[model samples]
Every structure is written in C-alpha cells, then in structure tokens.
Target: MKKGMTWLAAMAVCVTLAAPAQAADPIKIGVQGAQSGDLASYGVPSLNAVKIVVDEANAKGGLLGRTIEVVAQDDQCKPEMATNAATKLISDKVDAVVGPICSGPTKASLPMFQEAALIAVSPTATTPGLTEDGKNPLFFRTVANDNAQASLTSDFMLNNLKVKKVAYLHDNGDYGKGFADKNREIMEKGGTETVLFEAVTPDAVDFSAVVRKLRRAKPDIIVFGGYQPVASKLLQQMRRDNLKTPLIGPDGVKDETFLKMTGKDSEGTYASYPKDTSTLPEYKKAREAHIKAFGSEPGFGYYNAYAAAQCLLAAMEKAGSTDTAKIKDVLRENQVDTPLGKLSFNAKGDAAGMGLSIYQVKDGKFVELDHSIVLE
Candidate 1:
C-alpha cells in the first residue's frame, strides 16, 4: 500500500509539470513589414497596434488557450526582401502573418504564404490585383482596394472641385503605378482630360524635370500616387519651382510624415482614407489600450492592424484550432468585430462595406470632406 501511494504522488507531480508545458506552446504569429526606411512611418505604428491587440488577447488567455508569440521580420519595403521575410516566417512555423504593408511586397510574398497554407492579413496593401484574379485564398486585407479610393477621388475632382485638366505623377513601384493607372482611367472616363502622365524614381529628392513637364502640360491639378517620402519631396520641389497646381494624392500619402516633411507646403493637399473611427465610443477602449501600451496615440495604419489581429484571433477561436485551413474557412463564413467595425470578407477576400473619405490638409492636419464615399 505504501509503495502504491508513493507512485501515485509521483504521477500527480508529473501531470502538474506537463500541464503548464502544454499551455506554454505558443501560437506563433509573424509580423512582416518595413521596420526601417521611409515607410517605417506607417509600418512602426501598425506593429505597435498589433502588439497591443495581441497583448490584450494574451491577457485573456491567448488564442485557443495557448500563448502567442510574434516573429517580426523587416522587409524594408522591398519585394525580394519581403519574399525572404516570408520564407523565414514559414521556416519558423508561424501560424499566421500580419503584414507586408506595401502592395509590392505583399504581391511578392503572397505565393509563399499560400503555398505554406498560412493566413496573411495585411493592414494596408490596397492594390486590386491582390484579389482580382483569384490569386490566393489565404490572403486578406482589412482595408479597401485602391480602385475605390481612386474612383471616389476622381468623382470628387470632377463634380466637387470642378477640375478640367489634370496631370498624373507616380513612383515607379507596383503600388504607385497601379494606383496612378487606375485613377487616370477613372478620371478620363469621368470627362476629365489627363494632361500628363509621368513616373519618377521613388526616393528621388529632385523633381525639376517633372515640374518642367507639368509646367508645359499646364494642368489645373496634379494627382500623385505614391508613398509619403516621395510625395513630400515632390510637393516641396513643386513649391520651389513656383508651380501652383493643387496636388491630390492617394491613401499612400495619408501619414503624418507627409506633413512633417512638407511643413506649411503640405497645407491644402488632399488624400483619401477610410472614414475615421478613433473617436467613436465603440473604439474608446481600443484607443485607450493602444495609448497605454505605446505611450502615444496610434498613427498611420493603426486601426487596420488592430482589425487584422482581431480577425485572426476571432477566426482561430471560432475554428477551435490553429490549423490555417480551418481558420481561413472561418474567416470567410463569419464576421469578426473589430475597432473599425464588424468585419467580413467577400469571395475575393476583400473587406465588404469598406469605403473612402477624401481628406484635405487644413492648418497642417487632415480634415474630412463634407461627404464620404462607400466601396461596394
């Protein structure tokens, strides 16, 4: 009897030790984005938002009762580097990925994620090609596509601003060029003449040649499709060259970095974004939590990243497993409540009911237009 009791006590201790070990096996999440370079203005805030969401989820006993760990990889906003980051994440066995914030990087890295059966939810990659051709079933984004923003802006320019002749400027990257092309087509179809279409190497400090071309074209407005760094520089150079053509940019220029880079020159410029929700009562908790974790209010791409994390966690919980296939199916069939709103994906993995609002720079800040447009 004494021997049997001692054996039972040993077994109890073993079970106690093993229970914690089982619970400690973390569900790995990969965060792929530009941690450095000009795009960091957007990517860093997004990563901060992701951390806040994941930390909050972990506090309530992480997804599926397992701890969650983030495997962060910096792609520097480059395509090949993004592919390498995706490869590393696959090797590390991350259960899901949160980024590749730019469209080009996302495109380059998407095939690898699809092949590995990993769920990739991007907060910002808005190119239509991501979902147009049935490219990857496992990929999703919290934001609307560029087509919606471009169309809305084109309509606003024609109807509201009454612009006749416009010029197009774009960075040569996939994201910028795609956005510019879509906007050009829409504006032309809407009865606005495209006076000039030009591409500039991204990160170029001088726009003398482009400004000269724009002067020749004599456009009433210039639409730029590119990220903050290039957009800011182009605007500064435009002012230097005394070109008074009003410039409108896409979502890529909607960061605070643009204002900081262009100073007073950024005033009166325009950009489009999903309607702001940071002040709404529904997102009050999320906003406070983000500030608590990051020691500041969230910036560019914050809400979208939080929404992406919510989508991933909610899908994982609903599926009752970490299997990517199951989670993907759950994401398709179910709606997840996020700080942005209740979110659902369409057949193409695009967010349904997402839309855009045109914002103009007012006294060095972005303010909404009198109206907003929804993307169906």
Candidate 2:
C-alpha cells in the first residue's frame, strides 16, 4: 500500500510538471489572400513573405518561446469567400491575421474579424473606406491608402507632366473606383481638368471601345486604375490603336506581369507606390534572408507583408501574452524597425506618417522617380 501511494504521487507530480508545456502550444497567425484568383501574383508573393517572416521568427526562438504557425486561406477575391475565410480563421482561434490583399475583400471581411476581436492587418489593401469609417479599430494596414496615391499621382500629372486635361479609365472594382474618385477630387482641387471618366469590367480584354471614347476626349494623358493583367490588355489595345498619350496608373499596375502582358508597350507607363526599396543595413540583412529563404526576389507587397508580421510579433512580445486586446494596445503604441523603416500605428491603426513613391516603367522595370509622403 505504501509503495503504491508513492508511485501515485510521482505520477501526479509528473502530470503537473507537463501541464505548462502542454499549455504552451504554438501561436497561429492567420493569413487571408486571393491565392487562386486574378490577384494571385500579389497574393502568392504576399503569403510567401509572411511565411518567411514567421520562419525567421521561429528560428530565432519565436515570440516568448512559442513557435509561430501560419494558417493561410484563399479568399479568391470575392466578398463572400473572404468572409468565409475570415470566419474559418476566427474559428481556429488565430492570434492575429495578415491579409486579404484586395480592398473589396478586406472591406467585406472586416466585420467578421471585428466580431472575433482579432487584430486584422493588411499588407496591400489600400481603399480609403477601410480607415475612413472609424469602425473596426482592430483593422490595420502597412501600405499607404488609395487617397495618398491618388493625390500624389494627381499632383504629378498637373505640375510635372503639365497634363492639364486628362481622361480616367478604371476597372470599376473597389480599388478602381476608389482611386478614380479620389484622383478626380484631388486633380480638380489641384487645378487640372479631368475631361472624361470611364469604367470597364476587369476581365474584358477588348478595351477598344473604351479606348475610342478616351481618344474622342483627346486628353493629354490617360490614368488607369486596375492591376497588371487588365492594365496590360488596355495598354496593348491603346498601342494597337496608335494612341500616344502617356499612361499613368497606381501600384496595382506595377508588376512583372504588367510588363510581360503589355510587352514593349509598358515603357514610360507611370505608377505610384511606396518609397523605393529601403537599403538600410537592417533591411538589407532582412532582404538577404528573405531572398535566401524564398529563393526569389520579393515584390513591393512582400516588404509590407514582412513588416506587418514583424509588427505583430513585436506586439506579442511586448504584451508577453497572446491576448488580442493587449496585443492591439501594444501594437498601437510600439514602433518596430522593419525593412520599410520604423513602423508605428496611429489611433486609426494606420502606419503613421506613411507615403507613396512615384515610379515609371523604364527598360521593363519600375524606376523610382520621386519618393514623397502625402500630407493630409
């Protein structure tokens, strides 16, 4: 009887000792993006970027000695699909989430993330509505919103290009319409005339009809608001039609796909993006690691995604707990040094003092022209 009692006590002590270890499970970070839709070029790279950061964090002993696990889902660029993905992540009880690259999907899925009290951070969603509503305090973005890019692009057109009269062509998506409206507002305010504004479906390859209308306007320039694939098609059609006006667009049209799709027609096309690649020693080191891990060059969205992940990890470290509320507060207050320079969120969960860079496609690559912060 005495021997049995001693054995039982030893077993109980072992169980108690193992309890803490069992409770220290890996922390899961959910990533939502359009992995299989028209935006896959952006989404896949963005997802890989998140993976690189999480892997590096784990290799360096992770956050508070807990390994980071990425749980990714394809939102497919649809609102319903995005909401479903958000719900799935919330059901899995993720510590935080890192995307739905497109603006429409992000806006549609915001409510689900807010209800779950999850810290939803986006690397590429740039619609002004996300931040303008003053709702979803949990929402955060690393990229400059469309409003900034629009104002900058508008200013460039009016002052430098001396393009007083311009025509606007947008894909009519959330991203397209948002940029068009904001650019029009700012261009008019800046003393430039917008002669025509036209919207077209994103998947429509035959933009000759739209091109005809734009040519009729006979504006000095045409500004397109859409991604590379559609933008490439439109530009190709414009070239085929012998339109010579300079074509300007937002970051959505800035990618290798754009160049490939538009062929040699991409030359001289302008895009507004975040600042030129940060070559600071720290960012250089991180970039090296990223290239080594992914075995490829990171895109514009990659750096932003990496920054978002680092910010989340930093917040988790500061809080010393995975509690969403505490992490949110910590993130709002802390300034993390990332590849994109210092990152700090404001009351609206926007990266404080962020700006856009203007670039032109020269020799089949995005060449930085000017890096400027939009003053609100």
Evaluated with TM-score, which candidate comes out highest?
2
Query: What ranges in model 1 sit over 4 Å off?
Result: 1-24
Candidate 1 lDDT by residue in tens digits, 1-376: 9999999999999999999997678999899998888789888877887788889888998877788888899998889799889999999999999997889999999999999989999999988899887878889998878887788788888888988899999887778888789888988888889889989988676789999999999998989988999998899999988887888888879888888889988889988888876666546877888778878877788888888888898899999998988998998888876777777888889886655789999999999887577655
Q: What lDDT score is found at residue 175 in candidate 2?
A: 88
Query: Predicted candidate 2: what Cα RMSD to the true structure?
Result: 1.8
Question: How high a TM-score does candidate 1 get?
Answer: 0.94
Best by lDDT: 1
lDDT for each residue of candidate 2 in 103-218, tens digit (9 for 90 to 100): 98999999888888888899989888897768978899998888888878888887788878979888888988888888888888877788899888887868888888888889
Please give the range of 10 consecutive residues that has the lowest summed lDDT in model 1.
276-285
Cα error, candidate 2, residue 237 (Å)? 1.1
**lDDT against the true structure, each candidate:** 0.86, 0.84
lDDT of 1: 0.86
